[model samples]
Target: MPVPRPFPPRPFHGWRVVQAAFVLAIFAWGIGFYGVGLYIQTLSASRAWPVAWLSAAVTFHFLVSAGLVALLPDWHRRFGIAAVTRAGALASALGLLGWGWAPHPWLLAPAAALTGVGWALCSGAAINAMLMPWFDRRRPAALAMAYNGASIGGIAMTPFWAWLIAGWGFGAATAVVAALLLAVVWPLAGLVLGRSPAEFGQHADGEAAARPPPAVAPAAARDRAALLRDARFIGLSAAFAIGLFAQMGLVTHLVSLLAPVLGVQGAGFAVSLVTVFALLGRTVTGWLLPQGEKRRLAAAATFVTQVAGSLALLLGGDQAWLLLLGCALFGIGVGNLLSLPPLIVQAEFPPAEVGRVVALMQAINQALYALAPLGFGLMRDVGSTAAAIGLALALQVLAGILVLRRPAP
Candidate 1:
């Protein structure tokens, strides 16, 4: 296929489509993903649930979310992305409602797991596949912006949830959030997400359904077999796993931990502030992302940030500012990590295969990510919370060291 010289490449309409996707992505991430951490303190206080059990719920949430990503590619191939996302949104609403009103611990755990899976469908695996045809040159930055939606949601929802729980209680809050999601995001997806910018003839792929979309990474590189054999992929994946490990373990109980650091009253504000910085971190790093070699560069940056964030966790203070710094660094690094591996996967595979292959990687690593929290919580059960955090940080340091491979530069 020839690269036709369009008079002005992509125009305003293309940007409109990408912006729509970006908004939808942020809404999904905020309400669906980041919102979970906000509920932990309230849930625990109301039920007197042991941290370990709730930790399992968190693990199970990731398990379901990751499982959906691993499975949804085949689903999309059969049912289409729009259909799957709509179903995901509806399912998520159901799960969220169940979570807010459930009487038993068993009920809440399963409800959270279902929502996790639903989120996986719309936001995790399906998002990139949906946006592939929108813009050519600025996909990563756009994706970065989209992924930052969760951070925004996290920042925004934390205080709102705190207030809702304080004002009307958890049951009413959940119902309100669920109803809003059903009313807002579901309809938006129906209206805005059907056609990529390509359908409008103002995209990198033009209006031709048969035209190839812009590749995810610089494709003028080695073949898959050769690329896999390079060891860089392995190193990068390991480093990313470290970040995921830390993120999964800590984020599950962030509110709980911060309460001790900054009283129960201030914990919500602290978490929200951290999320605000997290969103800034992603936005800033995304702006700094290099045009070429985004894969390796991201791998390197993820290694550094995870290692640094892990080391910084020991810096505790009753004041909110220090804890906020830790969360910001961790959030930014992990958010970018979500976008990074897909770049390599995109480089190595076609657009159709991007979701599936990335799902494969996610399945392998997500299990590891999920287990970190469970294990850490068990250690905390033994009166060794510090020890648990220490072990996680050590593992991250080791992963970072392993990331130092000598590629053919």
Candidate 2:
């Protein structure tokens, strides 16, 4: 019999760090962060509550995260990656465990809320911050691929989760999800992850293992006051907030909103398919960003496509194929959302505060995301799809113009 090779020594440089980090971000966020959307319908169906009511749990998650992001840097400093990540994993497990057997909306809401809270801690505090200390040059692509894990995980698991929910029920599915969190993520967080590249005998910028991290320029390191006063970052944040509002709004009511088109048989199937397209968007954007400064091009293309797709629903209606196409377009636009703000922060803010900057941005992003679904639900409550789409398109155009005027951050 062939002998197994010994385990590779811990990588000090090159792509291994990036690879490990990316894989970890995927399971850490996708299954943890975006996977909540998959259960909205199941909750609504079982409870007979309005989609708005049940999906509000997602908004609550966002709210909690927004409130907590300011503390992320402090948390990282105090606990390190392994501790923070493991805590997140454990929170996820407990949350999922809570969700699995939740007998009513009261029980499920808290469970889902816990999962979202855990995600905020793990995703923002642990993953995003840790990446900065690893490599500077390939950071954009690495961050892109890592966050893309959300779409990838959602795509891969949503369908199966749907099947499980359909065949077995929420309790068993929650158990499986709990197992995935506890067995895989909890261990990964504690065993292999580190707080900063320095722990691995390397600089944050990924030069020779022995080189210390480059000292930050006084200018880059001292931009905090400027960041708050800066119109550019504020505008950029607003622009992102507008788009996120629409996207989160859609996710909040996706199953109910499109149920007419997808029908009962295809609801779960359609969501998974849309998420697959989102995965494609993430992969493509991560690849294209390396060769050129095409952030503007990406933003423009996505805006135009989203405009057309949202209008298509008004004009032609959401046939299965058309709806899928719209989902793809939405995903295409959203891929930029995953990376652009982080990239912008790296550019505009001091490198040392990258973690702080993201915390701020994420707070803004999540707060707006939390408010959107209810706002849209209220809009849809009183009007037709055409009216809602019209408003969204108009808002999107405003955001597009605002963002494109300056180029993506």
Which candidate gets the maximum lDDT versus the true structure? 2
Clash pairs, candidate 2, are 344-409
Candidate 2's TM-score: 0.84
lDDT of each: 0.66, 0.67
| Global Cα RMSD, each model | 5.8, 4.7
Error of 2 at 387 (Å): 1.6
Q: lDDT at 313 for candidate 2?
A: 54
Lowest lDDT 10-residue stretch of candidate 2:
216-225
| lDDT, candidate 1, 323-384, per-residue tens | 66666666566666677666656654545556666665676577678787566677678866
How does candidate 1 fare on TM-score? 0.80
lDDT for model 1 comes to 0.66
Worst-scoring 10-residue span by lDDT in model 1: 218-227
Can you write out model 2's per-residue Cα lDDT over 274-372, one digit (the tens) per residue? 666666676776666643335655665666766766666556475677776666676666667767677656655557777877777777877887887
Misplaced by over 4 Å in model 2 are 1-14, 28-34, 47-53, 107-110, 203-206, 209-216, 219-226, 257-259, 262-270, 290-297, 318-323, 405-409
